[model samples]
Target: MSKKKGWVEQTDGYLNKTPTFQFILVTILFALWAIAASLNDILITQFKSVFQLSDFATAFVQSAFYGGYFLVAIPAALFIKKNSYKLAIIAGLTFFSLGCFLFFPASRLATYSVFLIAIFVIAIGLSFLETSADTYSSLLGPRRLATVRLNISQTFNAIGGIIGILLGKYLVFTDHNLQEEMARLSDAEAIKFGQQVLQRTLTPYIYVLIVLIVMIILFSVTKFPSGKVRKKSGEIDSAKFGETMNYLLHNKRYWRGVLAQFFYMGVQTGVWSFTMRLALDMFPHFNEKYVANFMLYSYICFFVGRFLASYLLSRFRETIVLTVYAVIGTVMLIGTTFIPNMIAIYLAVGVSLLLGPGWPTIYARTLETVDDKRHTETAGAIIVMAIVGGAVLPVIQGLISDATTMQFSFIATAVEFAWVAWYFISEIKYDIRSTVTNKSHSLED
Candidate 1:
């Protein structure tokens, strides 16, 4: 097999010998992170009931998870700089496994605070995995296939979603009268019941931790095409963190894209976490659980859309796709707000069709504005910023749901995408101006 060039790496070892295992292994690890993210919503009430946590308290699940992204992103960059991808990924696996195991004691003790701590540990691990794996995966011999690389990783992520939803639904809610029990339980009864309910989650996560431990161990001994980039490169020569950040600060467009990433992520996370609730709560006749289950199919929309963007952009100019999806996503948001039917709720979910195209597209477009000076950190930082959407948008939805009806909370949610639109508009303006300048210069020449 011929070797590929640039940020792509396609050594025969990873390809001809171990392609299936390599993809499966990486996909499983990424799936662990996704399960943690998506399952939190399905099991939020379980957390609440078990620990007597409030909606605000339960929101900490998101806070701790996303907060870790910000906390660990820069540090993970440094770690990736200091260590090989193997070591960083192993460390992430260790963090994730240990984090999952902590849930057992948290379950036994039934402490909300412990659960938060446990979840934070999981997030800490995931931040490293994301930072290392995304970069590592990108380098594994097909930069052109980055969208495919990421999509394959994310398809497992979607599989994890299906697993989490099924597991959460099965375990969290009791067979008996939960509403009545919730309404009239004495302290002793509640605590006892909470313990059993806690077991439902605790058991699976326990198994997950064990599996993660083995995955890490196996990965340690196994060799594949090493895609490790030399640590930090030229970007981190300075001793002071402040100096590096200042360098980033001086790059105006780099920072602009980062901030835009933050808002875009907040919106995406907000919409995804709440889509089920939005369907069930807003539409009276539909069953919440059923609606939530049906919403899993929504992943198909996302998966298809992303693949389409990848294929389409392979041929067409990215500027065209970026402008179309951004504008269409905005239109969908507006349409979602006006359409009151349950059928329209599913149609609103189709907004994700356009939504899936956004990530890889945005990353490629952002690269246009950035220099290669701090490529990994700049790219990872943007992704880190996007996680803020995960933390902030849910609270915004929860708050809005409290003030008004649940349906209109999406309106608040859609505003986050407003930034996505701005990015697209910026792309259009930049592309047009560049094109016009090129044409004018050609005329002059």
Candidate 2:
């Protein structure tokens, strides 16, 4: 085969000699990180009760976790550059497992700062996993199908999020009345009770550690495709860092996708953080567990939406689908803000459905605009770093809630969805202009 035709065939086949097992394995990594992030959300409430932490202190848990992502993303990409994706993933799993093990000591010491350190370590591991795995999964497929592939992989991510919530609900939160009970205790007694509660929080991490070890073992034994990039000059190595950054800086489509991704994370994390509170406020008769189920439902909707969106992307224009869903999500959040009674809460859950494709779609579209395939890993890392928006925007939502109302806070989320919609709308125009320009040249020829 000629080199041009050979490359075209390879880029056109979805799994093009990629092992099914390896692809499945990489897809599972999506779920693992989602579980970590959702578990972090659970930890916030758990720490507030067990550590007797003020809201500001509890907020540090997120700060440490997301800060780790921001700090580790570039390093993780560099690590993948120096080593193989397999090696980077194994290293990430090792960090994750080690961090989980540290929870044992953190629980034993009952020091919030120690636990924060442990969370940061886990986030570091997650940063590595996300940076490698997301890019790796896309590499496993046809270039044209990358968006659908990522959306399918992220479906498992949504599932993992649900699993994390379930773990928190059943394992970590055995005593719903623990907070009330703590209020009744003497200072020393409360100290002892808090320590015991902290000890119980260690259980879920132990389970995660066990899973990570199994994953490590599997990855170590598997043989994977090289997954190297092919430059126009037929080189296997990636572009240099300076060249990559210069290209990225000039790639307006790429930076716009990154901005859209940032807003999407902000919308998602902000909505999840307040879902339960919104439920409780709207339905005063409901208990915590009862309202908490709405969050579970929201996660399920998100999971289901991903699968549905993946199918849609396979059948329709990705930008069109993304634009439609985001616009619908924006409308739903606006309704969530102004609608009264139970309907508003339902609208909030429904928004999760519309947002199902936001992250993966944004990621795939951004990577598509990278002219040099070698830059994919670094580009992926920068997008992963955008997750810091998750840490920042919820705080914005919280402040809005405090100043105005919880319902009013969703207006901010609506604006975020609007931004995503606007992004794709602009992309659609770009696509049209490019098509017209190409057709004009063809007619002249």
Candidate 3:
């Protein structure tokens, strides 16, 4: 009988000389942000019901959250360059905890705009965490296997997403017919009920806030690997934003990645934001709490997909695996849009399975475009900024849903995945040509 290999064997030395403990510590940061982001989906339905918002208006939940990622990513990168990834992680956790703490007051105020403010603050912190953690994870292993390593880390992120949706399903979503109840109540009674829903929303954040505090303390004490060791403070060249931006602009591959990430983020956010809406629309008998069960299942598929993608990435070409996922995702989303049946909605939920490998794969590939290691931090920041698509694309979907049916709105996500498929196809073509050219040159030699 053959002996079974462990995870280290499976990685094929991708983890060679990697700082195991530091990687574990930094990987936790992935889950931290994912929990916050996934909870936003629950918030969208809760806020829409409590505040009586249109689909378009309710999407501002994503807009405010990802908008902070857009604005803060560059500054967070600069901070990491001047300071350290470890410090940036701590700063992010602090900001996150602060934002989570604000949920108490936001709940008390029971104002949509105020809650958006708290969510934006949380996004600010997440921007810091993402800017630091993703780049940090890529650097933890061999450059070639960066995607695989990041995917391994992202598995925890999937777990966090699952936990978040579960928390929202149980703690936030109410079983009662909120619309009918609100319609029947007097103004004072409605306000009281709104406050109660807001209180339920605030409970999850409190648990998250406690976890963030613990993480901050743990990160402070742990020793993290330094990407670039500097003996003198003067060796830190933090003023290279202009140079880095110029370099990034000229890199075609990196821009392709940026576009892919943009669409992917948008579709990912929009799909989850409206999943509950779609569930309720398709099956009128389903309550918000029951619809949330589909979200839970969606995240579970995502969790499994991450683990599966990571394994496949280790065994196969990253471009090949990603291309397959993108293609499948595009087709599934198309089915989700046009097919008017239970299967159509199931396709939407199944999209999460394809989504698991996207962000990390694009991220690792984009960073590979930068030949100079010095620009990695800045380049990583700009890529993180592409997450703003989460802010923009969801609103576009929302507008479409409001104008058409919820089923038709998913056309936008289908288009987004089509772009990802094209990007990965181009990657495969480039790799093939490069391989052919190198082999021919070797024969001549």
CA lDDT of 348 in candidate 3? 88
How close to the true structure is residue 48 of candidate 2, measured as C-alpha lDDT? Answer: 64
Q: Compared to the true structure, candidate 1 yields what TM-score?
A: 0.82
Clashing pairs in 3: none
Lowest-sum lDDT 10-residue window in model 2: 1-10
Rank order (by lDDT, best first): 3, 2, 1
The clash numbers for all candidates, in the given order, read 5, 0, 0
**Model 3, 1-445: lDDT tens per residue?**
1111211211221233466777888888888888998899999988877898989998999999999999999999989888888899999999898899889999999999999999999999999999998988866755566766687888889989988998998888878756667879899999999998789988899899888998988898876655542323324334388988887788988898998899999889988889888877777777888888888989998988888887887787778998899889989998988887889878889999999988888888787788776788889899999999999999999899999988899999989988888889889976788789999999999
For 1-445, candidate 2 gives per-residue lDDT tens digits of 1132123324222344345688799999999988887777677766766777654455567777877888899999988888788998998999999889999899989999999999999989989999988888877756655655666688899999898878877777653555667888999999998898888778778788899999999999987655666544544557787888998999988999888888898898878767766765566555445555677788899988887887887787778998999999999999999988788999998888887888887887787788777787899899989888777777777677767877888898999889989999988976687679989999999
Whose TM-score is greatest here? 3
Can you tell me which runs of candidate 1 are displaced by over 4 Å? 1-24, 48-57, 142-148, 171-181, 184-188, 224-243, 283-291, 334-341, 373-375, 429-445
Cα deviation in Å at residue 40, candidate 2? 1.9
State residue 132's C-alpha deviation in candidate 2, in Å.
Answer: 0.5
Instruction: Pick the winner on lDDT between candidates 2 and 3.
Output: 3
Q: How many angstroms is residue 71 displaced in model 3 relative to the true structure, after the best TM-score fit?
A: 0.2
**Residues 325-414, model 1: lDDT tens digits:** 767776676666667776657756787677665654565455446444334543555465567667766777777766775567678656
TM-score for all models, in order of appearance: 0.82, 0.89, 0.92
